[model samples]
Target chain A: MRTIELSDRQEKIIEIVKESGPITGEKIADRLNLTRATLRPDLAILTMAGFLDARPRVGYFYTGKSSTQLLSESVNKIKVNEYKSIPVVVNENVSIYDAIVTMFLEDVGTLFVVDDKSLLVGVLSRKDCLRASIGKQELNSVPVHIIMTRMPNITTCKSDDLLIDVAEKLIEKQIDSIPIVKEKEEGLEVIGRVTKSNITKAFVTLFKKD
Target chain B: MRTIELSDRQEKIIEIVKESGPITGEKIADRLNLTRATLRPDLAILTMAGFLDARPRVGYFYTGKSSTQLLSESVNKIKVNEYKSIPVVVNENVSIYDAIVTMFLEDVGTLFVVDDKSLLVGVLSRKDCLRASIGKQELNSVPVHIIMTRMPNITTCKSDDLLIDVAEKLIEKQIDSIPIVKEKEEGLEVIGRVTKSNITKAFVTLFKKD
Candidate 1:
């Protein structure tokens, strides 16, 4: 159950494979300015350690083990709530044009449309506004509710979901972000937003382990 | 200015607001059951055109004329990329204990490792032979170079690159998924991976209007 430790040289080799994988052993040794003989053991040790892969005719490559290791580690470390950001909102009575402006001013891609109760009832995005505008639709008279994506079917994530799980949902669903919602006695209310940028930040922190 | 055409209800509101904005009107007749009678004229016109804001006691709010309407529209029309599945890998010579068992038997993760040539050296997964019967430091003595993250930074994607830009890179980043990479001649080797279930997928497809 002892953890395997890597020497600096081995680490470099692993990094190189990870960087330029599916390369030849001779090429790796040449890049490092070491004799194939000198690099062979380094390569062998790395391969034995589950960091590199060697093929008969093909050169060496770095394995995908790093991602799994990273994923397993990320699951244990990141708390879901920490990754959420406050949701951007607009009033239900607001014009579709106004919603579009709000999206730009806030520098966010999506906007949540809410009622007087502050309960999320619909969602709007740049796309909805564009479609409306291109159709030469009346700007001042069109209510966003007509074009907004309604609730329930909206993709949402809970505050307790793990970062890894969130990442999985993003990829599987091919979504740019997920609305974080909380259930109250009346209905579901949007509390925050989790976007692709958040996942990237979380991964960067996770990978910087000592 | 020639006003855009709108639904009957929308047209009436626009006509009312063009003459009476910043003025709250009560009991305005609207078509169907869709209209609320006690609504503000400016708020109705602005909200529909993407320009009005609302406050609690202050009634409807207006933020001047809207700008950057085109940009929001463009963002909405952009197409998203699909997620693809790729194998996970690990080095061979490294300790087979922690990795071999945890990732392999799971049947979900794969392991890639590299050799001196930098070619895809070896491919291991939950199905790899050494999952059970894990030994002591013998695992450490084994080199991962034989089993680790492999060449080409497989699953590599680019920054500033759109979703489809790295769909191919997903297969290259030697792990269970493709990692987002910065644009570089070396293909921006995997900095962070895009998995089959990442949020990008949802943005790429589900939310897309097409």
Candidate 2:
């Protein structure tokens, strides 16, 4: 797809069509005091760009679709599965100290906490761990489950979920990362992870790809 | 600007132009076994969209710009100043406990450390604080400068710098945020902060904008 900046006359034509749509090309040209031949290219462009729809007998109708709208449509097609990273998970019974070690060893901002069945139970952000580290309790004695953002409170997404929607969730919720999960008979199983880093990478990829 | 998918014929025309550009409309039409009148609209659309350029008598030259190239061009125009957040700062002499408290109070993932002159001297992430908290040193006794990532090690950006370039830096350095700084007589003054969150916001805004 190619993006084109509309000329003054083309904008005028859209304005006219929006006001008196289903009007013939000849009539649109007449309203602008231009010949039919002069407006052909502009009309063609508008029609092809999906801004205006043309009919043989009824004339041109304003599609009410703006250029930037297509940009969003393209972004909406991106799925979380395409950009998600392998989830770094720890059993909920693990010590906070061990969890912090896992986070540093994995070099990820967040970690998923799971049950004995390997079902997701909670999430650990660097913020959460840091908060726990400064607490009065000993880090080695405290289980991560005691401090993690627990289930029902944790924001989760599926692998097939739209990446843009997850990005929106990240902003709205003001969190660092989310666990991508899958449904099982017993509970939700952590399958992947999506973070602001993933979103940032996707953002960079948008401009880099041809 | 509006994005449009090119018709097969239009794509074919571009191929012809790419291979034997500066070829006249009549020549391109002849190669496709179509009349010049049939090709006028395609040529016009291509020229107006900046894919092909037409001269008075020299025919058309392929601009060598792909559709996605324009996407990057528009993205490159976004400046860091437009999306930066207020920089949360701490003093170098402040205790690590105080710095962690400042981080929690400010609710920012990163903090900029300043000297007695209130200029940037070091940077801190939650990871930094967590690491310090786990160490043998007492949080209230050790100064932040001892644990903070010091000068020449911190990544920084200017307000006027392109946001995309900063995004690349964030990915390359694997750091959460960068301090937006301005040069002073003695040191760099922290003006703002740009993080993966800011870049993520910018990505979402691209689609949401009209």
Candidate 3:
């Protein structure tokens, strides 16, 4: 495929389409402070480049598939460190209920369950809590270690993994998030987490707005 | 917090806010096939119940923080199976480069590196790919095993964890995704993946308009 060079105007047009797809050309032009005449050529280039599609009356909307493709390509070019987020953790001894409570209060989904040494041991999620509750398992009495998913079975991403790669995992696995980990002298240590929301937010920032 | 009983109108208003939060009252009313005047009381009830929030000019946006609280309380009522997602995986012999590519192409952030036995051994991520690429490490030659963050050190969730707990781990870890794993006779295998996007999407669906 021939490379389609996008001018500043063209890039802005793509962003507008992403945010408010199925929008009209006039609306796009108006949002970006450009006249229809000025945006026509850019629109043509974008459409030709497979970045966007235009309908007769619905205006221009980004092809959903194209955004994923664009994101993969762009993310491949970015270093992983640029996108790493902070890490959240739980200890093995923590009660499943406590861990569950912690997860809710923290606004995160995965908890890194660690040993007394702070060595990563297992991971816990809302599902585990649900099971314990349903099983009528004792919350405070039962340790997370009883139901936590152990390591060697955990999926991990490093700090330098690409955002596109992350996005792909979320889609392919139909999973929502992955943890960013690092190799320490002793073992792998929890470093960060990357979720589909982060990828979406990143996509919104990188390609959705001018 | 006191329980707030929602009328059909109020429930619809919450549904609108959840679907396209950070929207305005006017937009919500329009989408619900109602007038702003008709929606006002419902909106008030929802806001008071902590199910919805109103911004000055930004319209209505789902309060991400509040959802976590609501979720935490409601979590006690949800079954574990409701929050699980399918897992995506890669084999141990796979190259880091290939893994990275897989991640990008699949739109996922994490890859579970498994053994021929289908047992998870290590996890790879977009960040890992970035570090390897940036460090100019061998791409075609570097095996995922060499660079993978080994297991027993990774974080994970089970299919039965609570949603509130999952949310907390996600936020505290500052990571985006988590893997769901189940045990088998041979070893542990990944059963699903979860990310913030999934949680948010689930949350959005909770109040979606019919």
Candidate 4:
């Protein structure tokens, strides 16, 4: 993770720049009771940091905060727990027929398979069930465990982890969703789920006017 | 779309900082034959733009280039043509069985469907074929077009388009891959394909040391 910070003097300089539109360095220096040479550093710092904009003769004006900075800032601060949705889980013993209905009812492309202990054991996608149903296979008899991508293959995220890292994992792994889980006394218990949909929702909110 | 430019003086200041470790404003001013005030703006710009680092008492030092800047820079330069993989294509009239074999043999989740004119007409995936083969349907007799997601609904990218936008579309639309295509007189012609794997590959390259 990276951090960007501003000192008290720097903050004050930004405020001054904000209040006075297109003010010159000499004027700012006069107000601060510092020589132009001494005040030069602070004004330069503010302008370079993107808080202030400088023209050849127009002096400095507030450029406002950049969208990219706001985005990176929000992504760093937002945690998975804040926006994660409920993980749609089905018992591993459930018949593919029952699981399919559960998936459709939940309107999810992937399903987390939990054992009787409610511990996440594996993951199964819509394609997995579809392929399992092929060749006159009986959907009522086949269990999801028979076709699931088992543990050690599953990728999970923590509740407190940064959202962009979770997003990076999603893109890197090419998986639709990640089960947000933690190690409980029993086992790996699913807390919530972060899917492409959740990330999309966050992206939509990023630039939206408050 | 925001542009950040480094002036010649700013670049020279960065070069000096790189060679000399943690030099002071007074020393830089002496070397540049400019007063400390005159050099303030350049130092501020360099530090603010992440080219340099500043501490009031410790003077200035180089922080090198930031990873975020490098990632964004590489993303801008890398187009679909550079990162895209050769698109796996199947004739629209081919049997679902043949298409399935092609898909599995190519180890791709999606296949571009081309008509007799060799123009992309649809897209086929394992789920599409699996669903069509249910209820006593024969894979040998089924044509991919019947089960495939047709054009006008398919998402595509151009060779020159930015790769990050492509990655976003892949996430937002929840599609596994996008066909990089060009418009021909007949229709859209598949040039290459950018899959989640391709994006992952590009991401892997991003952190690689030059």
| Best-fitting candidate, scored by lDDT | 2
True contacts kept of each: 0.03, 0.61, 0.02, 0.08
The DockQ figures for the candidates are 0.02, 0.45, 0.02, 0.07
Clashing pairs in 4: A37-B37
Give model 4's docking category: incorrect
* Candidate 4 per-residue lDDT over residues B63-168, each given as its tens digit: 9764344324433555768888999999989888788778657867789999988899998866576556554567889778888999899999999987777777
Off by over 4 Å in 3: A1-72, B1-210
lDDT scores in order = 0.53, 0.88, 0.65, 0.75
Model 4 C-alpha lDDT per residue in residues A1-210, reported as the tens digit of each score: 222345667677777878996888888888788888987777766666567888878788988774344434424667878878998999999998788778768877789999999999999887677667654558889888988999989999899987767777887787878999989897799889987667655543442222
lDDT by residue for model 3 over B1-210, one digit each (tens)? 112223566556666777788898888878878898987756664553345667797777665433223322333444335866566789888877677767766766677888998987877765455446534567778888888788887777778776556655665565566777788888788887776666645443342222
lDDT by residue (A1-210, candidate 3, tens digit) is: 112223566667777888989898888888888798877766764664456788897888886543223322323555445665676788899787677768667866667888877778877765455445535577767899999878887777787766555555665555545777778888778877776656545433332212
Per-residue lDDT tens digits for candidate 1, residues A66-163, read 42232233234455688777789888888876776676577666788888888888877654564465345665678888888888657778898766
Against the true structure, what is every candidate's RMSD?
30.4, 4.7, 20.3, 14.3
CAPRI verdict on model 1? Answer: incorrect
What is the C-alpha lDDT profile of model 2 across A103-207, one tens digit per residue?
989999899999999999999889988888898768998999999999899999998998988998899899989899899999999889999999998887776
lDDT value for candidate 4? 0.75
Model 4, residue A119: distance off in Å is 1.8
**Which scores better on TM-score, 2 or 4?**
2
Each model's chain A TM-score: 0.64, 0.82, 0.63, 0.68
Give the top-scoring candidate (TM-score): 2
lDDT of 1 by residue, B48-131 (tens): 344444555443434443222222232223222333334344434556555554453443344555344333444443323222
